[model samples]
Target: MASWQQIEDDNPTFAAKVRSLFDAGTNKTIATLRRDGSPRISGTELKFEAGEITFGSMSGSMKLLDIRRDPRVAIHSPTLEPPADHPEQWPGDAKLAGTAIEMPRPEGDPHEGAGYFRVDVSEVSVTYVGNPADHLVIESWDARHGYRRRTRK
Candidate 1:
């Protein structure tokens, strides 16, 4: 796994595109694993600051409990469709998969009693339809393999 800062340092361009997708909206979708190993999706607000990607949940929330029990998570960037007249203008979709590291909430944090987690990214990817040729373009990054790009019809 890699820290958000490390990803930024190693792959600035890819990181910027991913960041743009994440910043395009306020809320993102997060998937967690329940005790029964079932998948649970939840709405969340993520913050990129201090060289870290962080989020918090209300105390005793199911998502909070889920993370405490199993830190694995996958987050999807908000979806934004292109204007009807300009289908090629879309910014594309991004996904981040990683393990969450629980951190102690700061003393003055409003959600001090809640749960806070910083992501240790295992994978980051973005997919979009390329213009002109209209082929699917996929870019991915990982701690083990670094960055890669692929295209499909």
Candidate 2:
């Protein structure tokens, strides 16, 4: 797992693109595991701040309860459809799989009773249409394999 700062330090350009995609959308999606190990997808507000990818859930929320029990999680930035006329120009979407460790409440938090967590990223990635609209491209990074790319026609 890597910290947000480590990712930025390793590849500034890649990090910038990831951050831009996340900023392009308002509500991202988070997947949490239920007690039975089932997956639950929830709409969430996410941010890249204080050198971490972070989010919070309101007190007594299912997500908060889920995180407390199991920290593993995956987050996907909101998506945007590519323009049919210029499909290759789509900026793509950002995603990460990580463990969300609970953090102490920050001073002056508006969501006073919310649970805050900072993700320790296991993998980070993005997907977009290749130029010429020939195929889909995935760019990814992980602890085991620093960076890699794959394409599908």
Q: For model 2, how does the per-residue alpha-carbon lDDT over 4-93 read when each residue is reduced to its tens digit?
A: 989888888888988999898789999999999999999999889877888889998999999999999999988999989999999999
lDDT of 1: 0.92
For model 2, give the 10-residue run with minimal summed lDDT: 105-114
lDDT of 2: 0.91
**Candidates' TM-scores?**
0.95, 0.95
1-153: candidate 1 lDDT, tens digit per residue: 989999999899999999999999999999999999999999999999988999988998899999999999999999998667765577799999999999899778886569888999999999887775468789999988899999988
Kindly report which residue stretches of model 2 are placed more than 4 angstroms away from their true locations once superposed. 110-112
Model 1: clashing residue pairs? none
TM-score of candidate 1 to 2 decimals: 0.95
Off by more than 4 A, model 1: none
